[model samples]
Target chain A: MTINSKIQNINCCDHIARRVGDIAPSGIRKFFDLLASMDGVISLGIGEPDYPTPYHIREAAISSIENGYTMYTPNSGIPELRQELSKHLKNTYNLDYADSQILITVGVSEAMDLAARALVNPGDEVLIPDPCYVSYSPCVVLAGGVPVMIPTCEEERFEISAEKIEPLITEKTKALLIGYPANPTGTIMPREKLEEIVKLANQHGLIIISDEIYSRLVYDCEHTCIATLPGAYENTVFLGGFSKAYAMTGWRIGYAVGPASIIAAMTKIHQYTIMSVPTMSQVAAVEALRNGETSAAEMVADYNRRRLVMVKGLCDIGLSCFKPQGAFYAFPSIKNTGMTSEDFAHNLLMEEKVAVVPGNAFGRCGEGYVRCCYATSLKELYEALERMERFLKKRGASQAATFQV
Target chain B: MLNKILRLLEDDGRLTPEQIATMLGTETSQVKELITQAEKDGLILKYKAVVNWDKIAEEQVWAIIEVRVTPQMKAGFDAIAERIYKFPEARTVMLVSGTYDLAIIVTARNMHEVASFVTHRLAPIEGVQGTTTHFLLKRYKEDGVVLDDKNKGMRQKVVL
Candidate 1:
């Protein structure tokens, strides 16, 4: 055979699949690329915890490795982990998910992909609230499903209510997808709102794809697991993880808890594509579920305190921040600055060495805002706020205006 | 609100009352008043740096002396622990459980100084039965702050 030096004479773009080619690259990526080459940036961009995994939980994984558990695990993950997760769900939300109905994947990212792929037929439509986590709409589109964006306004605290969603449902509507406490916004859907959405889904004969990655990060307010609501369990795919609460993002471990049929379908896809999550992560996750409540609570408490600081800091800088009920983000309004979210982010990074993700990275409705994650240390948060105030002072947004949380 | 203010100061004592007020979403006057009351009530003690002295030129030898004592009438180990902790060289003093009755940390300029204090000052105390002195070799962590900070700022600056 003749050896070929290059795969294509023209461009690699021609070889890309139509479905994959159509998905827009993340809006935050270009800014991140710029940030990578910069120095001394205090970032409030990433939706991740700054803390490391707790000592005991990490030790569990180490002990598992020492016990010679280096091989691939079962496709559905270790039975012990599944069982522990089942108990955890029941204990936390009073939802009954059997061990067989829990499907472990490589983080909730994979779990969402699996859910979309397993449930979506070509041309089906999935209703999603605008300004959600970036992956929500793309997951649907990549699965050959149409994403119908429902605009949720900032006036109503960017809430995902049923009235904003019911009008979007049509015959092809396959699911109602939501993530709360949402990334970039930190908006937690109230129990009543989730119930309304679940009820609307029931009426439309649609499934509910709920990404509850930040379920444990609620501040002062309690997290309402939609699946725990009456008659909502069978119709919802509940995605939870050890990332935010346990600070185990590097471990790449998450799972989906739902009805047996849906889980079986997701498992079928997971088995062929991933085979299994990392065995050590599975071991560590089991420990997280079984004995990590105190660590999770401590992390959430820390996040709550930082949440207060972030919101107050933003408001103090004259960028009115919407008080986030959950997660570690404060989505502050930048409309008064008369600068596009992208320009604000870029300028702030360039001028003051403070990196923040522009709100439009989530969706169109996020245009006049920017998400500031409060999972950083208080010292860094203070420094970031000071730099941001200096940046905004030059832009005339630093008015020291009165604001309420 | 008072506890929240105290918690913020507990994490970093260098924070001013104004900064503490901003962080906890409260008033500076209120925080100041509460902090004043706390200081008066002994809830807020001296604010100082948690220095890793080993990294400095003026490093001192630390010795943990476990004193096994007989409980005296009525006063028990409290009277003895009070007497030991009163020493200026004693860094920490606690009445412990198990084999030891009192555990005291003694910091001195040299090992000889530490040994001299353990024998001359500590063993001479009332009701002191025996002593076990263990000299500290190295300190990797102090007051919840890791000395090396090797893993500081290693997390990815941004992610989806």
Candidate 2:
């Protein structure tokens, strides 16, 4: 047979698993692709911090390499990193986890995947707050589990209360995944609200995977680690990383802490798949945990400053924004514009060269909102806000003319 | 809050009060008031650019002149320092605590100008006893700015 005929004979889709095919393409990808091709487009679409890793942390990684720490670490992670993470968790959130109970992975991204694969069984359901980080649902689905999105509204500051979650729990519900301070919405689940969820998780015998990547980026609020709650220690898998806090997205180092058995199970998969995180990154993470707190705090302060500017700018421009208490994003409602989130984002990108992620990229409930990250430089944020203002004015004028007609 | 605003201005003189207010999460009027107060109080002396003139084709000479001057009865080195610093050529004059009594940084059009300023102008002063001039060969850094390559090493745009 000819090459074309032979290739056609080997049905690629048939060979692929049905689970892989069932996974939808990421909603954020199209915007990212459009962003990549466009020049001079000010983006509030990104989720990571703009700052480089702190000097001391980078210095540590360099010294580690010079010291010939090029070999692979233990499958779980370097003991030093795990120890520092344990101490860090204890100091930051008053949560105590033994070093053995922590598994360092390639950022919270990998840890989220590991959590799903380790705990989820086929046909099991994992409940997640709607409009959360994009990876949570896909991770659950990829692990042979069904993802159940619990709808959260802006009136409640996008917080998922126990009232909404408790009724959704069925026998097949194996876990509840949550990230706070949450991405896309930039809302932190307050301690009192989390207590309700903890009670529900306990009553329903469900594991809670808490992604606390943005824990340190909170503005004027304390990030209460769900694992630190009274009865949550046994059932909660806490995922955190240096990416958001230390501005170390490129470092690709994060840790997961939980019950020893769950950690061991995660480690089993990690060993077979990832084997180990980079030794240099592990060294850098240790340095970040040890000496990078001040720098992290400073970045958080900067983000807080930018957050105020962004939220205020959005509101001033007639997009009603729910004040973000945590994370760097400002999710503003675009309902008054008489456009869908996608149309607003796309038209704004086309007309004014400002790129923002449509909130629906996170989930269905995010339809009339848009996510604007304030982690960019103050100058960029100012320019983006200016462009958005102009765009809004023009849109309003056109809408008014249409209404008159 | 005012101190924080001052430090930010000190780092980047181009930051407007509006920008500072936004970054500091304060009202623009408040930042304006504090900055105006600071200016009136002489807390912020002046805003000046730190220029690296070595990059230009025009030749400029800088010399560090160490002077040993007899101390005045009442004024000590302050009188002599004031005398030396009054000249526009003396970029900086300090009563140093080293082997030299007074250290003066002199800038001129050329080496000859600097040498002449040291010999005919600086050394001829009443209290001056001896002089040693060291001409600066190159400036690696000036006022916390590296004078080497101008490129800040552009950061790669990352997407998550």
Candidate 3:
């Protein structure tokens, strides 16, 4: 058939699912497209670490392949990986999970999808913090569930308190989704505050999906796994991975741990959809868990240095930023410029060739800020800061002139 | 904190006290004071460059001389090692554990100078029994810094 006739015959829109069409495209993607067409742009828009996977971990993967481990693993993942993950969770958080309670995934991204799909029925509401990672709401939507956003503000250090979450709960609420050492803001939820939410969830008979992918990247504070809290283990699905810690993002490996029934439910969906994570990646992840601690600590130290430089530079440039205690981003408020986050990002990209993500890309409450990732080299970060300073000064001068007029 | 500052200075001696302070989030005076105290304590001896002189027009010969030395009563290899290290031509001297008792790095104006130093000076010592000299033709890396490919970009321009 001719191409036009074939397209017409398919009636693509009718065939497309309503839920898929309703999901909004990522707000960061358009800026990426513009950035691709431009030259000499210094971007602070990336969310992942700039470091390559630690050499030993990569070597482990290479040897795993050389030893002929290139087949699909069990639906629940390899036993050794699961055992290591169990040990890791126990050793790090003092939380115990048998291997049967853990399932390896293609990343926290897949684990999140499985959790949503297995738990949410049609119209069940999942309460999530506003200005969260871009995928949380979409995953809930795709699972035929409603995502109710609990708006958090900079005053609370962007933490979702129980007071804010309690009032939002209703009979239809099924789960609460949270990620700490959260993306875009780098705010970590304190342990006491997490316990408050856990209590609330228990009272309301709600599940909690805690994404701890950035758990190892925390600076100046300890990360609390919600599963370890009193009365939370059976109700919490703890999602973690080696991506941020081991610099293994491209490996696409993560795992989830919880009660056996919930994991089995998720695995039932996973068996048909994704059978297993890559065998080589799982072997690499095992090696990372076994011996990658030192390299991970070194990367965290480097990130801490860059974080100070970026945060201080942003504050010096007239954008007030909170001291992020974890993760690699510095979220600075741009409200003084009298421009929307999108316009600020666009104009800065156009004028000074420095790319930063508009904060609203994360959520509605992220309106007056922009997320600047500081995981790049110190030299590039300083250069980006200089360009941003120039852009801010120009905008400030123009705004002052408008006021005078 | 002081050890961290010392490590940064050790990695790159060119970093000023103010730069180190900014990087470490401490006062510049504190870094200066700690470094000065460390210098007085002899924790840091001296700062020197690891240069690849072959890149320049200047010619300097470098040789690694393995020396077999007879051990003294109490000093072991210390007496002979001190004698070899006393010469300015001997860049480095170490008591080794293998077939050689002392490994000495000697730099000179030419091969003749190195030969003279080995035969005339190094061999004449009472404890010095035998010697083997190996000339260094090129230096690919020194002091953990890659000498060649200085212009090669180590950091990617962009990454996620």
Candidate 4:
């Protein structure tokens, strides 16, 4: 059949479900698709680290498969994995939780979806910071909740202040979703900011969902958990994964820790839905959280080195960057270029073949800026900088004249 | 008198000679002379009312692309860079000093088109190194004023 005839026979209207409107394609995924076909493109757009999964972690997965441990794990997760996760939380963030408060998920992505479904009632409002993780809003919407975005500014290094968050609350505001070591912008909340939010949540009786997937990837400061703050442990649901620190994006393993009540609700939903994370992945993650400290240490050290280089490089190149307190990413202002974030990023890709995510992609506040992930090798990082310099020299005339070239 | 009229309209072209003379208390002949001089100096190219497209609802997709490239190639960085800029996906380009060399902006109907550009068009070019792609997770304000925050939360939410 001809293409037109095939199209005619298929009922496009019938195939499109109402949920499709509620669930739109991710903007980050869209850009990756564009980059797939283009030649000579250098990208700092994806949040995932470029490092290979550490050898020991890989071996653990291999060992699981070899030992015939490929069978399904417990609905909550393997006992050892949950225990390790529990221990890691107490050790790192001073946040205590029993294994029962944790549920191993396919990834933090799954944890986010499950949490939304478990907590959000239809039409309930979820207060997500503007320029948040791409997954949060969609997940909230899919769970039949409304996403109310709260704008954060660059002056605050994109860190949402509690004062800014307090007034948005209402009777219908069911939860507050916050991510630190933020993806598009490498901003992390200080203890003071978390304290304010914690207090406010307590006042309004709000649920606090913390996406701390980038916790171990922090460069400048230590990763602190809001759950550690007094009174927050019961209200906050902590989301974490082995992806950034262990460079295990493909492993698809993460866990959530929260109050026993919410944890029970999430586990019930998870049991009926995803069942459990892949057995090998759980094995790998357990190894990562427990025995993978050396690898995490080395990787974080390398990222810190690259982070310094990248932030300095962007500054030297005139894309002013605020010193990122945590995370191995830099969100640089592109305002001097006289172009929108999308325009700046597109031009950089087209002209210099260098790719960065536009600030606007994260939210309107991200306009006139772009995000650069320094989770790459020193060699790739420097070379990408050189190409960017040349491109900006030609495109950004005022800034170009200062270049030695 | 003619200067006052021009200043009021911000340009001589916006008003006919008769209108300007009536408004400024000047003769039509003098108004015409002032218009001719302003045009000769290249101060005014054309007079048109600026249209704010933001007011209209349009199906628009925006993306920020991170790109990597080899600075010094066998042929030179310019040729490879040129190839990247030539693609329709590129709307803006900049060379940055960081983990990646160049930052690009691209727009398309959907995610598939952006992906095609990366895999099919970009990665294969000579001297083209590596790339990590990030799609916009959310947007708060685009040009200047708040765009997405219909709810007033001074503190923004971002997940890196």
| Best model number under lDDT | 1
TM-score of each: 0.94, 0.90, 0.88, 0.68
Tell me each candidate's RMSD, in Å, in order.
Answer: 2.3, 4.1, 4.4, 23.0
User: Which of 2 and 4 is ahead in lDDT?
Assistant: 2
- Which digits, one per residue and each the tens of the lDDT, describe model 3 over residues A1-405? 699887778867787899998887776677778887887878898788888898899999999999999998999999999988888887988888987799999999999999999999999999999898989999999999999999998878899999999999999999999999999899998899999999999999999999999999998778887898999998999899989999998899998889899999999999999989999999999999999999999999889878877877787778888888788888888888999999999999999999888999889999999999999877788899888888988866222211100
Better of 1 and 3 by DockQ: 1
List the candidate 1 regions with Cα displacement exceeding 4 Å: A5-10, B1-5, B18-30, B68-75, B78-83, B124-130
Per-model DockQ: 0.62, 0.43, 0.29, 0.03
Inter-residue clash pairs, candidate 2: none
Of candidate 3 chain A, the 10-residue stretch with the lowest lDDT total is A396-405
Here the TM-score of candidate 1's chain B is: 0.93
Model 2: docking quality category = acceptable
* Pick by DockQ: 3 or 4, better one: 3
The alpha-carbon deviation from the true structure for residue A10 of candidate 3, after best TM-score superposition, in angstroms, is 4.6
> Which prediction has the highest DockQ against the true structure?
1
lDDT of each residue in A346-394, candidate 1, tens digit only: 9999999998899998899999999898889988999999999999898
Docking class of 4: incorrect
The number of the candidate with the highest TM-score is: 1
Interface RMSDs of all predictions?
1.7, 2.6, 3.5, 21.0
